[model samples]
Target: MWGKSTAAVFLGMPLSVLVVGFAALLSHDQASTTLPWLLLFFLVWIAVMTCTFLFRTGLRAWLWMGGLTIAGYAALHFLKASGLVRIAA
Candidate 1:
């Protein structure tokens, strides 16, 4: 099960990378470039998740997943504050 899940992640990360690459090429904007960076981040995440599956317990996996979530939220917050995105009242 662990092997299967890890392989799934390894395979899936490249698809995400491709999607982001296509997106970056399809759009001509600063935001588009940054969008690919987000994909790269996720690729790293998938790799981490796959690797952490080897642990006896899933503590590191949980921590890394939680940390990624927080980091994503923080990125959104900063992007909104910087006027890259608008927050609706």
Candidate 2:
């Protein structure tokens, strides 16, 4: 369905980024982060894409994934701001 496809492309992308970014933040070994995160992004993205179809409608998919992505990003931001987690540049 077109709705699922759009959700997979739009919502899934940012959600994957947030997942990988948070994971990378938690990792203390920043030296070897990039490659692993790159790999993780694909895995997370595939999972997210598949999960989108579980919703009954495209709008539902967008709402849930969007909300989830927002929540995850907020938590990630909080952790970074509180100095509980940090990503090495």
Candidate 1 deviation (Cα RMSD) = 7.7
Model 2, backbone clash pairs (residues 3+ apart or across chains), number? 0
Tens-digit lDDT string for candidate 2 (1-89): 78877988899989989888777767778769867888878888899899889889888888888899899989988888998876676
Q: Write the per-residue lDDT of candidate 1 for residues 36-83, one digit (tens) a residue.
A: 567576766566556656645545444554455456557656765788
Q: Candidate 2: where are CA atoms >4 Å away?
A: none
TM-score of 2: 0.82
At residue 19, what lDDT does model 1 achieve?
Answer: 43
- Give per-candidate clash totals: 0, 0
- lDDT measured at residue 38 in model 2 versus the true structure, 0 to 100: 80
Among the numbered candidates, top lDDT falls to 2
